[model samples]
Target: MARYKAPTTRLRRLALQLRQLREETGLSHQQVANETGLVASTLFRLETAKTKPQLRTLRTLCDLYRTSPERREELEALLRAASEETWLQPTAEYLPGPYAAYIGFEREASALHNFEPSFVPGLLQTEAYARAVIAGSAPKASPEEVDGRVAARLKRQELLTQQEPLTLDAVIDEAVLHRLVGGKAAMRTQVEYLREASRRPNIRLQVIPYETGAHPGMHGSFAILRFEEAQDVVYIESSTNDLFLESQEDIGRYSLMFTDLQELALGPEATDALLAKVLEED
Candidate 1:
């Protein structure tokens, strides 16, 4: 995704820029908060991307920072981008709490590096497979809720076909192929879909064999999204929580892990063959 569409990153980018400008003037967060009369926590959250900054607050910071006209205008543009109507806004009520932010970034990502040790990534799942997985995971969800969630998931896949397609490089553990989430038929169709999706020019799929046990990704499923202008973000998921990491340190660690896993997993051609083999066995 590009910065134009990923407002979540725009917020983050603006936050980072604000922090940088403050640092350039040798002003601490506490000092800036005191000068601006904004609470320290507010400045902290703005810098950390935990909260969106209001235009007034931003203008105050720019004034304090004594930003050049060109730089200030660029920051204003970023602020506008941050407030732009995001793709996630329409389905806001249905999406899981943190997922809206994640999708906001995902929508504008130019390339995605995803690793799933359990199930197929959402972007690659067939509708029936998605429904089955959702039903199993959220057993108490009303049928309407389940349908809304399914629709939202399917809608997210539009990024793959958008005017500027998102290039996806995915690595799945062999266990994902073995676990039957939706029943045999659903699983069968899911695998078939993976095989076809992998063939797309923008998609790259790999599988880590059971033999390559105990890898970095064994801990959980995570994705690294790359944007045209914003720094890369890493998303880590658990049954109960979703986390997005943008720090250079965090990005570096996940980036290396992904590269290592890619080296250890089957290449694209072999992965396709493995998918075909799994389909036949199923």
Candidate 2:
């Protein structure tokens, strides 16, 4: 089944700030709820990001929290950004859970660090490569659904080419290049696409050779997204489940893992050469 996704970063940030401010004021959730004429559960859901806070709610919380004008402006700005129409929001019902949130974060991220031990990272995937991956992963999906997914994924690639693009640092395993996702021809095309994408100034691509064997990335594929004003987030992707980690400790572990992978992986020059070689063999 395609996962259901809702953009969560803006909402999450606003919620966290509200909770923090309330705590700083030494007001319990119930106290704030009573003062604001909101149910405790409603306030709890807002803070936990289970519900999006309305503008009225935001103003109320801000007033109760005694925020300075500058702080209040920042919080309101965050609310606006969160409430804005994200590319994926219209299709959130069709996306996988947490998947939409990840894309939402991707849209606003200043930089992205990706470690892929499987197929190519989605941001770097070509249309054909994405179709192959999506088809193989969801054999039972309807043709229309498949087309929708493929379209959404290709649209996601716009982030790479947008004016003022995000910096993408990707570490792809050697096995990923070796694996034939589409047919041999399609795989070759995907490799060539990767080669070209790697040449872009905003993208830094590396390949970890097979000889490295059983590395830290064996645990699974994960992405660390860094934002301008929002907190850093780590996304862990597995076959059956996906997790979003925001705690500093979780971010640290993934950040260090990417660093180690970068150290162990081939340099850009060698990575280019390796892709060229793989293409030749293909």
Candidate 3:
């Protein structure tokens, strides 16, 4: 069976609310199941976002929980939203469950703030650089599979150039520029691409020098995606999976971490100057 990806913004919010309501009411999954005549595992799956709940099932759950009329209406709206296909459908065949969630969040984000500690962020990677990274990371991937991912990633870049382009503030650890992901020539071209991308009005690129040691974001890389109406989400990627945080508390913590990283990073002018110096070394 294909793994189920977590729902998009609206659906996620609804699920969060559902979980909150269950907690507030002090109802265990088994208790809720007993009240609603649904299986405990089914209730658990719905709350944990392991499965998408049907509209009727959602309405029943809300009714059983005695949710506010306004909140119920909001959840119904999310149910409607869940029925729509995401823009990331093209890459669904290749993307794992967690990655599918990332693509879904990327599609709706009005602004993206990302910090990369090891390599260039996906949206900023040049095609050659991206191909090199993918080749090195997934040696077993077929040529066709690699091509499909590269195409999808490049297409995602168009979001930065659209009529209503997303605001992209990307901060990179200075080491990423020096790491040579694709060897000397490829690295030089990648640095040049970053330099050009930084010139765009919608993009703000900064670099944190290696000298700035032991920062709050040293643990891992993350992106905070802000949408117009939905709450901001924090996406944290690991070697095998990705986690999305939507709770106000978790989002606030990640936001603080991003702010600290931003403060430690070089200003755009200085960052651009440093990038030029790196390119010269190549």
Lowest-scoring 10 consecutive residues by lDDT in candidate 1? Answer: 1-10
Q: Give the per-residue lDDT digits (tens) of candidate 3, residues 1-282.
A: 253343677766667778888999999999998889989998877876667788889988888889899988988888788768766666666666777778778877899999999889999999999999887888888887688678778888989999999899998899899887878999999999999999999999999998898787778899999988677889998878788888999999989888889999999999999999998878
Clash count (model 3, backbone only): 0
RMSD values, in order shown: 3.7, 2.1, 3.3
For each candidate in turn, the TM-score is 0.90, 0.92, 0.82
Candidate 3, residue 277: how far the Cα is off, in Å: 2.2
Q: Give the worst 10-residue stretch by lDDT in candidate 2.
A: 1-10
- Give candidate 1 misplaced runs (Cα > 4 Å): 1-7
State the weakest 10-residue window (summed lDDT) of model 3.
1-10
Candidate rank order under TM-score: 2, 1, 3
- Runs of candidate 2 exceeding 4 Å displacement: 1-5
Q: Tens-digit lDDT track for model 2 on 1-282? A: 553545657777888888889989999989998898999999999888888888888888989888999999998898887767767755565577667778878888989999998989999888888999998998987777778878878888898899999999999999999889988988999999999999999999999999888788887799999988678999987768889998999999889999999999999999999999998886
**lDDT per model vs. reference:** 0.87, 0.87, 0.85
The CA lDDT at 97 in model 3 is 75
lDDT of 1 by residue, 1-282 (tens): 112233477787888898899899999989997899999988999988878888888899999999999999998998888888876555566667667668888987899999998889999999998898889888888887788778878999998888879999999999999898878998898998899888889999999998898988888899999988889999987778788887899999999999999999999999999999998887
